[model samples]
Target: MSHTKLIRMTVDRTVEAEPGVGPDIEAWRRSVAGVLAKSRRVSPDELGERPEDLLAIRTEDGVTIRPLYTSADDVPEQPLPGQFPFTRGGDPLRDVNRGWSVMARFGVNERDPEAVNESILAALESGTSALWLAVGGDNLPVEAIDRALKGVLLDLAPLTLDAGDQAGAAANAVLALLDARAREGDGVTDRSRVSIGLGAAPLTTLFANNYSPLGDTAKLRSVDLPGAVRLAATAVNREETIRALMVDATVFHDAGSSDAQEIGAACAAGVEYVEAMLEAGLSIDHALGQIEFRFAATDDQFQSTAKFRAARQVWARVADVLGARDAGAAPQHAVTSSAMMTQRDPWVNMLRTTVAAFGAGVGGADTVTVLPFDAALPAGALGVADSFSQRIARNTQLLLIEESNLGRVLDPAGGSWYVEKLTSDLAHAAWAVLQSIDGAGGFSATVESGWLCGKIEEVRAHRETEISRRKIKLTGVNEFPDSAEKPLPVGPDGTVPDRLAAGRVFRYAEPFEKLRNRSDLHLADNGSRPTVFLAPLGPLAEHNIRTTFIANLLGSGGIEAVNPGAVESSGLADAARQSGTRVAVICGTDKRYAQEAPDAVRALREAGMTSVMLAGPQSAYPDENTDVSPDAYLGAGIDAVAALAELLDTLGVR
Candidate 1:
């Protein structure tokens, strides 16, 4: 459980109010003002120039997180558990008591049916309660579904498929497998425990491939209604628990959609499916019952939990709008974000996946698949079952469920003002987006029109900017990188990633990864990696901070920083010469720069340094006529990728 009192922003003030609480609202305001005045050491009105501005912070989705929430905030009417709107949760008790299903992706290599069987069996034998088999292309061969699931007790574990273009074939293969493997003599198979979720996500295909699954973008706008209806009717006839339609947000979320964007996309997609199922003649309840939602559970615990909660609540509103009352209770499936997993310092991924699983479980996912830490690695790169990372990933889910006992609490994030407000805020934002999609003629129309990808690209562009500017921190790649650790040989020749062929993939660390690859290749070819000389302008005290800043910045791109200890301005050229580095970074305080940088930069450029960088804001240095202004500035918001790329190009590392 969480201790909210520690985090809640409260005031320390006492005032006697009317016994019936008349005018207590004013008293509360006074209390807040008193606290602010004391903290800011200012008058109540001024409060540090603009005190009200500090009360809220804006998110990527344009929702403001306020410092306080009270009855005055005008929140939308929240519903009871299992009731209309379902803001509290879809079900009264969501995945509590028993926890979420511990599912694994169960990657298979060699396109061999036997290899698939080994992977599934090993995962199941080691605490996995469900399977997420990603078939088609480089993943599990679609033809090997039966062989992969061979010997698996259908009564024990549920199976979900991410077969991309082959969803229909994979769904049929699952049904056939259950028919042949889970039965005896002439009686039907007891498949109540066999939860078969088929990703009938045409929108996913459209966004991922721009309509390669279907004939063209025009066909993508038209859902295969007959196929979906047939699958729903089959589930109804087989007397099995099969969710025929999947509203998967994992693809979009990993593609750099914001929390509200992913939730809105899934809700809108689910709405499209509901329309199809209803058109197929199933009742609203059954049509909704056949649908399940899948989203990415990331390491941002609060956002992950809030996103899951928002997904359920927003979809409930959509269902309500569609006249499916009980349909609000959607089954949520969460897999940790594969894009967040890093190839460098892969060991830290255990922490990432574990927290994500916790958030998914707490957020009310029915099933949570913790992808292996080396999930970024292609299968067989580290041998069968993805080596020890797979085992650790399984144990991560197990420990959270069994030892940590996260499932014992019902709606653990409920009741907190922060979480409740965020949940409601996300729902409203996501519903507006869903309405926009509906206004644009649903997922199919929007995707076919390319408007959907445009929204995603907009978000992706912002995210890429932040990532390159280091405004968004990636632990091992851009912050505290471990140079001693061996890099994971996890890609296609350490360059082109094969995952884009598998699904809609986007990674923030791709630029740095490419830089690392170049660095590795450079080292292999020249017997030494690219080096940049840090020419400090004074004693260590005068330049230590800038020196460290520049080194860490350059180090992020796998560039070796050659620090010729803090030297006089006169020795700057000699230091660059002695280090034999083609690039030099000037590090000093602004005052020191004003006094020494112009001469030092001139000398270094004269010494044949092709590219010169200054370690401060671009405005920190005055314009000079001596041609000593830095070629580039390495500061807080500068693009790390562009900076590193320029340095590498100058050093001839390409």
Candidate 2:
């Protein structure tokens, strides 16, 4: 062949003219058209006038996220990680080398220092070397302090204290503990091996909370007591390693912040703590080295991971403000919330724990505590549940670090569009909140004004609603029903006894003596019914609204819906006609009414659809004369699964 002919042939073989959007898009377009055709042919209700036009992406704080974010997404200029304003991250290795901490938390009472030591050792053995000791101010017994110190690697110091008044008894108790640690040693090597768990000063507490700076009794609880403990963590073997004592995320998670809020709040709190300590005669370096952090982990992986990253960013920024931007970067610890635990189906807790653990690991939490499944119940009855929970937590990290090698990628989400966007959004939102707190005077003022509580309660309400609607599934409680479950055992205290309290001996007391056997306490369990019917009003292929609606609903209820293929009005009728449907749900865009809704409804009604329903907008009202009026509407007021659940309730299924 001629040279030109050969060149043409080669070009043709190597690259053809651009294919018109590929067969997949064509197929999808055809499928969507088919769905619309069916809807127009069979359903009238589906063609309702109101249509879902705009997609609003708003945060819980009412902050709207743009569809696209660019470098311009940041305001006041986006600084590089480890640089000033540290939004990306404070350390040079933000997402590349340095990672978060995996610290363990221990309640210190020290009745049996040996047992406490054992617990500490157990945590360390599990690969978490850092610790947080919960102490009761002056009320903390010497035994608990001794116990807290017993088994911990000398490098692991804890933030030890309870929420209580800081003066008098609490102050005295904290002082005693600190005095003990101080007496243990003083020189470099001795102090190097020691750690402090001091109370926040009354002023520090007030300032941190945005209070009126009053010396009031209740407001004085979080103050710094005399003789605080200090120790170094092996985060990176240097200030650059991003490993040191951290502030617990639980404080904020428990305080009611969203994942973003938690990140910002923890960072702000850390900054406040460090600043307070510095003014009190401690060096910026010591303050950074001494302070640590924690956060609550949940099933939302991206959100959780972003939370950890945001935390580091905020801490880095704060340190920069104080001219100690290069100081030791403490780790962030994570714990699954007891507040989210449920008694309905304890087994589901394992799944929740697993997802949360995964997020913690990916998010770079130095230490994570997976609340046992039976944690919602008395510990003894936890039985196999705790084993699974522990397994999930441990194996999750192991798999990530060893198998997946996720640990090899520090700041794994540094460059991802979603993560970076989320990080920026969270940092900005949290910074705004922090500024508001500052404007109110500080942490003390916010606490006094009940502003802090208000912030938390908002998230709490959302969580409760999600839990109730099964939007965020809790296996036994919201999804699977355990008919055989027994009534949870009540402790002498009136509420359900802590599962942790039953089987294990108190560190302050006996030598591994078993506590009360409360396994007899179980929630009432009924046999499970796995059957579920998915009701979609429009044609399977054509009625293109909420395609994932049924699937999402079923998944949340622990039941997977089976679609009967892409059908239109006739197909829908046929489905309701042949399937043993316990419930029927109608799904379509409101605009479907203008097309094929009337016929679809008639077919469904004709097919003996007893449980006919519409998945309409919560705020929309049905026209008084609409022939496709459903027996019930699922959405808004009642989510899809919730509607099914109501039907189930009628059938005595739950």
Candidate 3:
């Protein structure tokens, strides 16, 4: 036998702080002011007129991120993990061993039960610790659940079902399968260790179906909210580890709700579920225990981390108010946001998902699911993640857990001034939203009165405006787009299949992708992409920056920018004619534009150019009636989507 070498390390906890021994808050504030003053003096332009405003960033959720946070900030006294209010995490020792569970999601198909089983077994044999099966409604048929899970050991793998309207039927199917497995004694150990999430989300379903409780009360009642609550009670009585309801906030998030809105909406939904369960005769603690939460983990690392933390605090507060203080902490499952996924340049999605997974793990999610990078691709069917994509998704979490050891430290983000302040701010904002929802008569009432949907629409409009103005840059879609990339396969009708047939889902990149699709169709018909001639007024050095900017902007909409090198003002017309494109954009420095852009614009117009565009702002010309006047101005902060669509129309791409 070989002796193992055990290395011992020491830690120091000797310096204990008394009440009087701490950092000087007033001195720190003075130092911060002095630093800001120095920065304004040294780099006035960088700081702008209001240096303070430059330091703070306001999120879409209306949460302000300060430039610097210190112990001087008004942060609440944070309790340890597993304590009441459980802001840090639900479980104190959650990070000690395996950390968060790596969950693999599969789209079930009744037509191919054997294939689905093979995929399931492959995921289990790999690094996936849990399974989230999309069942019913174009997914696995309720009756086919047993066949779909043929080889899977029920007691070993934790299962979550996303059955849409068929949640009760799917739950019964799973329960039947579990009963069969128990009777067979198929390596079944403790039933208490077997976790099953029934996924009965009536509010989310109603929202997805766009059913107005006021106008469509029959449809609302048809959702069988009471049935879902009763099922949860039944599941709780059957097994301790079975969570019968899920407050899935991604439904609101995908519709463009902000972080606080998503959290508040989720909490409101949780309260609704708890109330329904109580009406169904389940105790408060049992009702709370039977509910799990699902949130969308975005690429915003700090915000995503703070969101999960704040969500816990908000839910704990709600439960405490409901007299279930001890059962406040519930399991949270984090899935990377599909809204952030890009159809163009899909490889970049891997980076996005990686960051999302990291944030979720650090934020203390009980289970993390990384959707495949190509999840946004038109895979011709719903829930269709190829084996290669599945492997990458599975390994993404494994590498984070096994190699990076991201979860070894408990509350890794705890004690940091920035995280603490952000968490506190988010908690307060989300709780306010929940209170508003309650005042509006809870989740169903808000949905019926259109108050909740109206709020979501307002945020969606803001997000779209920001995206169009390039304030919210989507890397592969609206920023550095790959126009030459080949298109992914679509359905037979040439349209991308809708993942959610009934619900509305918004992808940040959809507008740009639409333009790209039009460009692709044009390329297929004309043997070349819709081309825009770049008419540079000065030398390469002077025009390169603006030319590069214009080219990137054009490429984002799949338009080809044809640069015929540096040309004189006289040659602008010839260049436009030679390029054989009616649209011509003059690119040069502001100084150069003032010198030669008038003649250049006149030349392109006289050459029969339908649209003459300037790369710089309209103020560069100062006089709109002069020969320098372009049909449109293409510059920073211009609506890129509208500009590109106009250019495509002018070029006759459609």
**Highest TM-score: which candidate?**
3
How displaced is residue 370 in candidate 1, in Å?
1.4
RMSD of each: 5.9, 10.7, 5.6
**Per-prediction TM-score to the true structure, in the order listed:** 0.85, 0.60, 0.89
Candidate 1 segments whose C-alpha is farther than 4 A from its true place: 1-56, 67-81, 93-97, 110-115, 134-151, 163-173, 176-194, 211-223, 379-385, 485-503, 623-627
> Any runs in candidate 3 off by more than 4 Å, and if so which?
1-50, 74-77, 187-189, 211-223, 380-385, 488-495, 498-503, 624-627
* Model 2, total clashes: 93
1 versus 2: better TM-score goes to? 1
Once fitted onto the true fold, the runs of candidate 2 whose alpha carbons sit more than 4 angstroms away are 1-56, 62-101, 107-110, 134-141, 144-152, 155-249, 267-275, 278-290, 328-330, 385-392, 462-654
- For lDDT, the strongest prediction is 3
Ranking by TM-score: 3, 1, 2
lDDT accuracy of residue 364 in candidate 3 = 88
Write candidate 1's Cα lDDT for 1-654 as tens digits: 345654442322234454666545556566677788889887777654435546677877888887666666545556666776665566675446557788877654447778778877877877888888877766678778888887887666788877655777778898887777646532434657567887666656556555222123222231365676677767766667888777777767766788888888788887777777778788888888888888998898987888888888888777777787676788788988877877666668789999999988887787888878767655554454655877888899889888999877766777767777788788788888888888988888888898877787788788888888888888888877775555445334557343322344676677687887788777777978789999898899989998888887877888888998967677778889989787888998999888878787789899989888789987778766346688888888888888888778788987
State residue 421's C-alpha deviation in candidate 1, in Å.
1.2
- Listed per model in order, the count of residue pairs whose N, CA or C atoms clash below 3 Å is 0, 93, 0
lDDT of 3 by residue, 1-654 (tens): 223322221112234565577777556555555678686565434444445555688988778888767656756667888998898899977646688889987764444667778888888889888889987765677788888899887666789988877888888998988888889887767788788998888887666556321123223212368878878878878853799888888878887889999999999988999988888788888889988999999999999999999999999999899987879999999999988888788889899999999999999898999988877765533344477777988899999998999878777898888988888889999999999999999998898788898888889888998898888989978898887788554333334543332135678888788888888777777888999999987789999999999999999999989999987677778778989788889998888877777788778888988888899888886574474588888999999999899888888977
lDDT tens per residue, model 2, 350-374: 6777677777666666556666666
